[model samples]
Target: MPTTSPFALLLDVDGPIASPVTRDVAPEIIGLLLDLAVSGIPVVFNTGRSDDFIKQQVMAPMIAAGMPSTLKIHAICEKGATWFTFDSTGAGEVQVDHDLAVPGHYSDEIRELVASSFASHMFFDETKRAMVSVEQNIDADNTEYRRVQADFDAAALEAMIRLGLGVERLEVSLPDANSGIEYRVDPTIISTDIESVALGKDLGARRALNLLSADGIVPGAWFTVGDSRTDYAMADWLAAHGHEVSHVDVRPGDGIPAGKPYPVLTAGDLGLGDEVIHDHAGLAFLRHWRAQLDPGMVINSTELSEASV
Candidate 1:
């Protein structure tokens, strides 16, 4: 153990393991993730991303790179509306809370809304089984997409009102949110998520922890890594459940949140400048833990830094 007790990792997918620019996982990340799992770390992926997206972008790569069947991994996807487990055999049967899904007609309306109005800037996410999400097109200019995103978000609110759906709109810029509301419009850097009030990072955290505990994989310490403010909920849930945990914000440029019961870390704390945010910060921390678990194990920081960039 690195400390008095072993620690498990709770991770958010995007902006951590995957490149925001390329929307893909890197080979180095795959290797490091497996190294940790193989070394007895319990790793869970908690994200608002859909199971299908995770299956393709994160899971497939890990399996191909040789994730062992003995190592079980849980993915809490679509916030908390759906989930599945995986190992070397590939993703297991997916479980979903269909009751939490927005009405299909509403999803259909939003799907058409994006197609008819925002096709240039975004595209409807077909893989989503619960939430209604539209991500910024990879080829779209960030400047232009951010500019138009508000308009689309506003339009979504109107669509919900027209459909008689109770709604609240949450922004990453605003940290506090009522996660139990009937519905919400959450806008992030590359996408806007419309989900039930029951779906949240907190809910995802609870699910992952329970899943791990059920299998007797509980750890004395947990490290939750993410790039968004909402990601704080993971650590919040763990602490509330009487677990010792810390949260690492890979992109702290938005500002470190104030008054958390647990310690909050940022990549900048390790001296990675503002320029090296997001996945680069995530890489640094993963390497940090890898070294911690195997004290003094030499990782070529300079080489890994160049490769991650």
Candidate 2:
């Protein structure tokens, strides 16, 4: 294996960091994150959650749960539409870099098309940069969620086709059929300005990664963990840039993209698959990677105690 030390961990909040809805992070997984922090690995939270939402919902809970205070942690939020850095000097201060958030120069026609076709379902939110959040009426209990998703998917597919934005991508996903479903359109489609809205999200993630690299963060040495189609672009970007990508899902096969050659760590069908982070097989892999950082650091023996079971 290629040896690299002090690897940066890019974690996806919903899948690897915390469970959905209940907002509970497993004890063992917390231990693992704590261990990584204690061992001096830099971990960055990369997610679709907004900056304010991540701090309040994810980071705050982790810190309260005895996570290491000295760890060098960073965050890329809003589906890579924003980047924030937390350092020893700043302490609780979060510095935002907006250049990464702006969807590179896009044509006006794409915006008009999105506005006309999905007027009721889509609207622009002015958080970091103007991003269009497409709301889909989905029924989680009934079969309507899937139907709604298909409609949204068809709209995005058709938009992309009409605009001819290759290289620029749009990501359509079922956020949480239980709570609600939302998708994002990109800002820059090649052929038609109308398709740019579908490409906004895909463009944002790519821009964020580019910004990270431009700021001296190497992609090949970085690791990203996530779940869902919105995260697929980031995964694909990392893998293409020679970075290691891991997908963490509560259920092994649930919602994960098919035919991606990356490794996936599952917490089982429900949340029972926590062993993927707590057990020997999982810990061993983490330790092996951490070992490249500091040879003296050791994997906790207790982690693998249940291996025979």
Please tell me which predicted candidate would have the highest TM-score against the true structure: 1
RMSD of 1: 3.6
Off by over 4 Å in 1: 1-5, 171-181, 299-308
Q: Over the stretch 112-156, how does candidate 2's per-residue lDDT look in tens digits?
A: 644665444433322333233332222122243334334544565
* Tens digit of per-residue lDDT, candidate 1, span 1-309: 122228888899999888888889888788889999888888899999999989899889999998887877899999889999998988899999999998999999999999999999999999999999999999999889999999999898888777666788864222223332478899999999999878889999899878887776768799999999989999999899899999999888788889999999986666556677777888888887888888678666565466446
**Model 1 lDDT on a 0 to 1 scale:** 0.86
Model 1 Cα displacement at 121 (Å)?
0.8
The TM-score values for the models, in the order shown, are 0.93, 0.52
Clash pairs, candidate 1, are none
